[model samples]
Each structure stands twice: as structure tokens, then as C-alpha cells.
Target: MNKTTLRRRTFLQGIASTALTAASYARVRGANDRLVMALVGSGRRGREVMSAFLKTERIELRAICDVYDVQRGRAKEAFKLAPTEIVALEETLQRKDIDAVLIATPDHLHLAHTLATLKAGKHVYLEKPSSHKFEEGSKLIAAVKQSGKVCQTGTQQRSGAHYRRAKEEYFDKGKLGQVIFARAVWHDFPWQRRKIAPQPKPAGLDWERFLGDAPKVAYDWIRYDSWRYFPDYGGGLLADILTHWADVAQWMMNETRPLNAVATGGIYHLNDGRVNYDTVNAILQYQNWNLTFESSVLPIRNERPGVLFQGTEGTLEITRADYVFTPYKGEPTVVKAEGNLEVAHATSFLDAIKNGTKPSADIETGIAACNPVHLAKAAYWHKKRMRFDETATKMLSD
Candidate 1:
């Protein structure tokens, strides 16, 4: 067999073995009734996801994993978990009792942790902006497909009430006919970036483990606390909020990848020693339409953050909770969102696990959402337009 085929076969065999092992453990522990879950990386986003999972009584949070003792202790106290439950990921994934894991680690660690979780025979709920680099997404997608697991991405908008309605009632219905252009904007005032001096590493902190697969760097409080500002840990605002809007655009348009991308912006306000830009304006060109995305932490306009779809007959404005339809000649109509998206998203994962189905934001969907953000970053860094391959699987240089 060819090398690629041989590798794939071996990977599938490993997954089968893991599944059989987990199945035996599940039968012994009555896991068919309720799924046992573990939370990896108990930071801000980790706690937020924990809250959402708690809203549903279907799954039990059995363990917490983190490199730092502080986050592990915090999660343990908040969740009434045992000290034994607060352990390393290597230990948590070894627990066959865990039917699934919620991976809220940094972007750089996502690919490794996700691969390990899938290999360990557990379902994964990974946060968005799935990888630190663009190339890592393909590996993640391949692993998820081979493992035959229910892996969900944390693009919660796909499960939101208004967002669903907008796609079904407006976009899919063609009420906004012949959509040619779209604009998405996120303008807000973030807290000022401050210089944090380096301090001694905390006890029980596995610094090297936190830097897995990332370039070696001395531990700094600023980099650790504000990881989004550095490329090693995060992809800045592009990977932060831009990925959400890009996903929404792709979902609304029923498209995955764009044909070309260009971006322009800089760290206009935050003079702090951050590597990412604070202001960004990017455009993604598709075969049938174009999507323009802009994000600025400096603009203090009266308008809140939203996305606008301009079609031939009308325009639809959408936010996290609501959507407004403004026809060319008729009065505008608005729909307020109903239900909690976080709960819905979490519930969907559990349902998918039980039904052996795919969640709304699966691995492919996550990669589709994250692809444009990576392209935008490339365009910004290179100061040139970038072209996406015909298959939309790889980004090509200009």
C-alpha cells in the first residue's frame, strides 16, 4: 500500500482498538445511561463552557485537567470536584469512564489535545479557531473523520434561535434574493492592555506542557494571561471574533471556502507588546458573492456589533440574539431570539453522542469557519491578496 493509505489504515485500526476498550468500560460503568465528561484547560473559556454543560443534567463533569495548579484548584472548588479529579490531561484521557472531553485549551494546543482525545476513544467538544496555524486544521479534520467520533466546535451561533431562523426564513427561503454582498462588523472597547512584569512560575505549573508543539519561549505573565495577543498561543482578534462572523457568513451563504482574501489593519490603539493587530478590515471573495468583515476596538459608534446581508430585494441585519429584515419598499421586521444558545449547543452534543449523529458545528464545519480567518491573517501579514485553492482545502500564496 502507498504510504498515505498505510498510515490511514493504521490510524483506523488504532481507533477501533480504542473504541472496543472504551465500550468494555462503558458496559461496566453504565455509561449508556449518562455520559461522563472531563474539562481540559480550566481558564475563562473553560469555565464558561463548564457553566453551559451544567445547565444540562445529561452529562456529568467527572474530572478537570490543566497545566497550572491555580486553574485546576479553581475548577475543583467551583465544581465540588475531588482533588483526585484535578489531574493532568494525560491521566484524564486514560480514564475509560470518560465518554467525552471538552477541550478549552489554547489554539496552539488544540490539535495535539484533540488528536489525543480522539485516540483515547472519547468524543470532543473543541472551541473555535481550531488551530494556531492554518495547516493544522487539515490534520484535525482527518483525525476526526477517521475516529468516527462526535466532535463539535464551539461556534454556538449555529444553534442560536435567531441565527437558525435567519438561515431558514430569510437566507434559505431566498427572501433576500440574489445575495451579492455581505458586511460583518465587531466594534467594541476592550480593556486597555497593560504591561505585566514576569514573575516566578507557580508551583505545579507545567510550563513546557503548556508550550507543546509551540516555539520555545520563557514563561511571561503577559503572554500567559493575554494569550490572544500572541501568535504562538492565539491568532489575535482574527481568530477570536472574526472566526465567529466568518462562520455565520459561510452558513448563511451555504458556502465553505472563499476564492480570494485580502486584509489591512494594525495595532492602532494597543501599543502594548502584543503581536496581533487591534484594527482589521478584510474582504473575502467568493464565486457568487463577497463577504467584508471589519473589527476595531477603537470605534465607539452607537451601533452595536452585527452582520448585514445586502441582497437585491432586501437587507437582513443579524446579531447573536435577533435579526431584522428591511425590504426595499416595505416596513422593517424584526425577530427577537428565544432560548439559550449555550444550553442548546451543549444539549446538541449530548444528543449527537447518543444518536450517533453529527453536531451542528462538526469538524469540517469548524475548519470551514476558521479557514477565512487564517487567510485574512496571511493577507495582513504579507500585504498582498491570497488565493484559496480550487478545492478550498489549502491557501495559496499570491
Candidate 2:
């Protein structure tokens, strides 16, 4: 490793040790001492995470911030928070009582929000795809290490019992002998087959704030509500949905980043005038195995939203709900998953905060999961195979 990376690793190690000691001390406290958390960006995913966090008895939602009045109003109605509690991001961060901030903002704003939250001396539960660009993820890693705060990425599958068991029993135990090919797929039809006419920006919506750091554009509700379709706002299907399965593939294969990437797909069906592609098939090569990921907005739901591992002995298919294992010579086995994964992941974040431990999906793990995502996008844009540096810390131009 380079000197800078070595130094950062050493620094993070020291912080982890100190946090572990602090967690032990914190454990002695009473159960009444709950952690205060605030939600920034009360969008769909934000509300989902908040709902999961609400299931955790150890956390109390003290504040909710959003650029849209509708989302803030909905959050207030659901959580029964006072009008004063639904405020702006700056005001939410200023509150000293908030122990942690759950950030579910758009892709373009993730870096800015995360950095501001860290600077405000609050732990962060950042959603997936750590940064808008590949290089920005490194800055986040450094910031997390320097702050020494519990930062959990939203790859909740890491905390799922099924994923843990699969990783431990099948992959780690060498049961999935010589895993050669891993395929991840996420297919859904969340949009209309026809084109959508642009609507006026809704009242009480801060369009400028929502478009912070993104390229300035005329206010359009289609872009605002379904921001994932735009390049400036989101990373299309790859970043939005593929991130989950890519993370799982990386975790199962015990890989941080891919060796190279080549992609070929486009907006073949959904012609909604969206800047980003609707259908994308990307192939990422790793040292030991290869991962092929395909995502689209097609209505066909064949083998929808799951990861498949092909090994010498057998093939294992894993989803958030359960896993199916099939051996070459034996009958296929199915394992049903128990408990709520979202709640478990939220609890892991709270535990990490109270105990000064790293959450199952820590900052580094988030960065690792994002590697192939950013690379695939790059490959699609450049129309050329892309590779990461030897250290897998930086993306190569070629």
C-alpha cells in the first residue's frame, strides 16, 4: 500500500481501538439512555430507514429535515413530531441533542451532507453509493477516519442473518468451492411504459436546495420526483438498485473492488427523455471470479432482484428474503430468512454508535461496494473497459 493509505489505515485502527473501549463503558449505562437521531431528506428511502429506525427502541427520532414540504409534512404526520421539529438541514445539524443523523439525500448531495454532518460532530448513517463520483469516496473514507464517529453505510444486507450465514457457512467455509461466476440482477417496472410530461414544481419545494451541487436546471416535477432518471441527479439503475446486489456479490466473494469493467446497454424500452439509461448490463472482473450485473425497468420479473453464485460444487441464489442452495449431485435446499433485515441493520448502527464499534456496513465497506458501481458507469460513458489501480484505491483512465 501507499504511504498515504498506510497512514490512513493506521489512524483508523487507532480510532477503532479507542471506540471499542468507549463502547464497553457506554454499555454500563442504563437502558433509558437512548440515542437521538435526525433524518435528513424525508424522501421514500429516508422514510423507509426512519420506519426501520423507529422499530429500534433504543433510538428516538428528534428531528426531520427535507427540501420538500410534502415529505416533511408526511414525516411529521407519521412520527407525530411537532412543527418545530420539521426544520431545514442546517437547523437540524445545529441541534446538540441529536446524537446521529440519517442521511438519505440524493446521490449528488451525499458527499456534501456527509462532510457537513461529520463536521457538526454527529455520527452518520449514510445511504449507499458513498459519493457521486469515484474519487469523492476516498475523501469520505478519510473524513470518517479523522472524525472517529460511527458511520454505517445503507447496505443493510451485510447485517441480514441469511447473508451472514451464507457468507460464513458457504463462502467462508469453502462449501461454495471455487466460485467462478456470480450474477446479480434487479428488474422492476416502477415507471410507465409511455413518456411522462413534465409538470410544474410543487409549492413549498426548495428546488435550488434539492439541486445543490448538481447542474442548474429549470424546475420540473418529473426530475424532482424521479431524480434517478437524470444523470446530474442520480446514477440511473446501476447506482440506484444495482448497488445492493453488487455489495452482496463483493461481500460473498470477499472482494473490495473489481479488476476491470465492460458494459453494454441503454434506454431501449423506457423512452422517457431521461438522461441516464434504463437498462444496463455490466460485467465486472475480479481477481478470482467475475460478476455480471443486469438491471432494467422492464415489466418482466424473471429471477428478480437476487445474487447467484456458480461454483464448482454447486450454485447458491440469495435474496433479502431467503437463499436457495443446489449441489451438483444432491437435491436443492431452501432456507427461509427470519427477522426483519431493515430493523437489524438499523439496530447495528445504533449499537455501533452507543458502543463505539463499527457497523456491519462500515465506511470502507461502503466504498468497496461502490467501486464496481462507479466503474461500470465510467465504462458505459467512455465505451471502453476500465480498471482500477493495483491498490484498488483509484480508478484508471484506461
Candidate 3:
């Protein structure tokens, strides 16, 4: 067998051998049963997700986990949580009372955190770009399957009512005929490029824990505060912002895997000691169609954050607020988004657990959506066209 296949088999074998016992699995909850949930990471995104979970009925916040005391304090203050509720991830996972975990950790910690949560026999609501590296996607899928838990990925658009309606009306019914080209864009605002001043590491902040498996280095406030722009912790704008729109494009097109990808970008504007690029443009080649994604933190004219699908018959554009379709010869039709996306997504996760149904953005769906972004990054880094081997779940050498 090839090296990639061998590696995949070995990883799967390891997961199977270490699978949790039957008794360790989380018990099924009834329709009205209260779900005892914990929040991991407890950062800005974590707090936002926690707020959404609070809006859902019958969800009890049992614990909160974070490495930084300041972040923990912020979560406690925003949620009215008790000081005792703050716990380390290791201790929190050991609690039998906790039924599920909402993990909004950094990209690098996603695979490790989600795998540990699944191994602990708890359901997970993992944030987007599920894996830091492409190979970790299969590991996550295998662990979730072994644990048989409802693991939802935080691509909230998948659970949105308007998104579903637009899919059903336009792409699903052939209203947009034979879509050939698609574009996803997410340009950053000026505030996103704010300068970070170097400061001493805060007291009681576990910098090592925050670093996770990343290489050890002197504490830099920029990397700690804006980890998304760093290559070690995150995939920059592509993984942070483009993944959501790419997932939507893949979902609407019913094409999950991309055959190959070509990407180009650089840190032209925001020279803030970040390794990741500030401007990026990538094109993913599928079986029959192509999808492109572009983003830059620098100022650009008429910049909008959304996805556009162009077909033979018409064109459609969708964003967080709304979706509009304009036929070749008819007036454009617009549909405004309704309800809270995060709240709806949280509710869907709860419903999936209680009903034994797959969440809108399950583990497999999450990985599939992320794979293309990973491929694009590979192409960008290598400066060559990169192809993906779906069976072995690895990027092929040029």
C-alpha cells in the first residue's frame, strides 16, 4: 500500500483500539431532558457561542474551560457564571455531569480538543475549519463514529432558515441552471488590522497550554491575541472567513471534494510580523465546475463579504443578512434572513442529540467543507498546483 493509505489505516486502527467502552458513551436524552453543556476556549468566539447556547431552552452551562484567567473572567462576567464554574479542559472532561462540549478553541487545538471530548463520551459543537491540518479530518470523523455522538461543526449558515430556503428554491429546483462559476469573498475592515503592542504575559496565564502542540517561542501578545493571523495557530483569512462561504458553495453545488487547487497571495499590506498572507486568491477545480475565493485586509473598492454563483440562466448572491437572485431577464428576488443564526444552530445541535439525527453541519460535512481550504493553502505554500487524493485524504505531490 502507499504511504498515505498506510498512514490513514494506522490512524484509524489507533482510534478503534482506544474506543470508549459502551458504558462510557453519553446517554441518550429525551425531548424535554436538560442538556448539561460546557464551553471550552472561553475566548471572544467562545463567549459568542455560549451566548447562543444560553438562548436555547433546557441547556445548562455546567463548566467553562480556558488557559487565560482574563478570558475566563470575561466569560464569567458576560454569562453571569460563578467562579467555581471555571475549570481546566482536563478536569472538565472528567465530569460525568457534563453531557456536551462547545469547543471554540483556536484552529490548532480543534482536532485535539474535539477528539478528547469525543473520547470522553460527550457530544461536541466544534467551531469551523474543524482541523488544523488536513489529515486530522479523518481522525475526527473516526473518533466521532466510534463514540456515536452528535458533533456539530460551527458553519451556522448550514442551519439558517433562509440558506435552506434559497438552496431549495434556486439550486435544488434547477432555478439556477448549470452553475459553472462561483466566487466567495470576505474582505477585512480597517479595525481588523489594528496594531498589537508587545506586553508582558499576564499573571496566571498558562502560555504553554495556550500554545498547545505549536512550537515553543517567547510570548508575543500579537500571536496570543490575534492567533488567527498566525500560521501555527490558524489558516489566516482563508480558514477563518472563507471556509464558511466555501461550505455554502459546496453545499449548494452538491460537490464536496475539489480535484485540485491553485492559489496566490502575500502579506502586502498588513506587515504586522504575521506569517500568514493579508491578500489571497484561490481557485478550486472540481469535477465539472470551479470555485474561487479571494480576501485581503487592505482597502479595496466595492468590497463585499458574500458568495456569488453564476449559472447559465441566472446568478445568485448570498450573505449573512440575505440572499438575492437575479435572472437574465427578470427582476431580482431578495429574501431577508430571519432568526438568530447562532441560536438556530445551537437549537439544531440540541435537537440532533435528542432525536438521534445528524446535525446540519455534522463531522463529515465539516471536514468535506474544510478540505478545499486546506488544499488551497497547500497550493499557496508550495507555489504549485496541488491535487487532493480523496481516498487517502491527503494532498498529492506535484
Candidate 4:
């Protein structure tokens, strides 16, 4: 069969599978019902998010999955989980007891893991930068839609009280009138840089499985430990750091789609074997405003990472902890943040599952947040301006 015919058939098959899966798991959960959760990719980041999820009420982590025995063992000890509770991802998904899956795998494996979780009739709490590349986003969107599952993206700021207040008091209420430009900044510390040392791969670590769809190469400890610094496993600063700030900018401005983007950066410092840039400066154009994100690993300044919006009437700068609004004519106002972001985000996910409502950061919002970052990365890689075609979901050279 031709490509189009094959794709159509595959789409139809997916719809049928989703229908069957939904029918088999069609039990409406009430508010008081306990949620059985499974933690996939139980590495450092995975365990951190899992702990936050556990803070929420009426949820139990029934199973944990990780390719590396060491990481899995760490998770088991940290969470006081039984040996019998550990299982492979496929086995964990097969169990009907799991109501949702928390996925914090490498960027490349997110699409596959999330799709599998959804197909198995379980809700998903996927980490940020949902897809490794822009091309994988459409597939994820389709899978989430067809499965009718509540997929919450891990943009914790979306659930932040300070973020909402900043949006409502400034952008939404015209405190920051006619906002024209916004900037997102993240400065990495020295401790974040991974040490480059030649050593044997740790026993029980599945190097090949960790590679996923990335290029096959000899095991490098630095790459394994600092996968975010490499293009194969992650999108460097753009995908790793910028996604959060850009999401905040878009969320507060109420504009998720960007028209075009251009980026320029290089691996200035940290002369490691990593291919992805260490510093990046990207600009994304929207309908009424422009957004820019800049990140650097070099110890240049001690400013906290945040998003700032400059408007005609005033300017608003916001971070996870608080927000400051400085009017052009009047005195400045400050609002301190409240509550734990991770717990709040997890609670939103649980509430969505129980109430059948959308999450604070749903799949579409997640994809939209990543859209500009992807375009900016592509622009940097290709050394050309990239335009996003929202309807076609394609990035084109400008």
C-alpha cells in the first residue's frame, strides 16, 4: 500500500483500539476514589516528581519501572516500596490496577511511553518537552485525543498561584498594557556541569535501552549522566530550560502559537563532548508581541531565572517564587508565591482524572509550549529562520 493509504489504515486501527481500550476501562472515578499510580523511568528526576505526586491525597504508587537496576533500587528504597511492586513498563501497563502513569523518561522516549500508557487505558502525567523533536508532537496529540485520556504536562508553573495572580493582575487586567516584548532567562550554575571522566558503564544500567532512538555509539559516562547536554537524548538549553519560561510567557499573554523563530548560540564554555549548545538566544514572533529566551551555563550573573514582560503601561517580572509589577508612572507591587508547585500540579492532574476536567497544563498546552522551542532549536541548527505552520504542524524555513 502507498504511504497515505498505510497512514489512514493505521489511524483507523488506532481509533478502534482506543474504543476497545476505553470500553474496557470505562469506570467513572469519584472524588473519594483512590488513584493507583505507577512511576515509569524511576531515575532521579522521576523519583522527584513521584515524591511530589505522593504528597497529594488519595493516591498510591503501586508500581515502579526503570531500565537501570540501580535507579530502580534507589526508588524502591526512597519510597519504601516492596520488591514485588517493581515491574517493567509493559508489565506495569498491563495491570488493570494502575489508573495513571507518571512518565519522566528521557526526551526521546516520552512519546512512546506516553502512547503506551494511554493505549493501556491509563491517564498520563508526562514531563515537559513532551516530544524530542517537533515531528513527534502530532503523533502524541493524536494518541491523546483518540485515547480520551487526561494527559497533564509537567509545566508546574502553570499550576502556580503566583503565576495565575500575575496573569490576572497584570496581563489580563491591563496592568501591563499593550505588552510588546517578553524575555525568558535561565543561568546555569557550575554544579550543573557534569564531570567528563572515562569509566566503565555501571552494571545493571541498560545503555542500549537508554539510548532509545538516539544514534548508536559506545557508552560514555558523561552522555549517560548529562543527557540533557546532547542533542541525541535532549534539546540542550532550549528544550531543557527554555520550555518552562516560554510556557509561562505564552500562558500569561494568552498566546501559545508563535509565527516564526530565529536562534543563534554555540557551546562557548564547558568544552565537553556534547553537541548541543551551552548558550542559546532565541526570538519567537507572535501576533501582537515578541518573545525571547536566553540561557547560558557560564557563570555570568546571579540573577534568578524568570520571564519578564515589558508593556506600554508597566512591566511584569515573574518567577516560581514571586512576581513584581513595576508601573511606568506609579509604585511597584510585589506578590510572593504560595504552595508547592509540584504538589499543586500533581493535585491538578488527580483532580482532572476524578472530575473528568482538563488539566492545568494539558497535552495541547504542552505541545504549544514546546512548539516555539522546537522552532528555535531548528532555527539554531539550520542557521535560518523557521516559521511554524500551525494547521499543517510543519516547520518551514523563512
lDDT of each: 0.85, 0.86, 0.88, 0.86
Per residue, candidate 3 scores C-alpha lDDT tens digits across 317-342 of 99888999999989999999999999
* 2 or 3, greater by lDDT: 3
- Whole-model lDDT, candidate 1? 0.85
Show pairs that collide, candidate 1.
Answer: none
lDDT at 2, model 4: 100
Residue 234 alpha-carbon offset, candidate 4, angstroms: 0.3
- On a 0 to 100 scale, what is the lDDT of residue 62 in model 3? 74
**Regions more than 4 Å wrong, model 2:** 1-32, 83-87, 191-196, 391-393
What lDDT, from 0 to 1, does candidate 4 have?
0.86
Model 1 regions lying over 4 Å from their true place: 1-32, 80-87, 189-195
lDDT for 168 (candidate 2) = 85
TM-scores for every candidate against the unseen true structure: 0.88, 0.89, 0.89, 0.88
Clashing pairs in 4: none
lDDT of 2 by residue, 1-398 (tens): 99999999999999999999888777755344878889998887888888888888787787888898888888878776663545467888898988999999999999999999999999999998777788888899999999989899999999999889888888998887899999988887565344667767778898999999888888888888888888897888788777888899888887876889998898887776777887899999988799998878877676537999999999999998899989888899888789998899999998888787879999989887887899999999889998988787666767
Highest lDDT model number: 3
Q: Write down the lDDT that model 2 would get.
A: 0.86
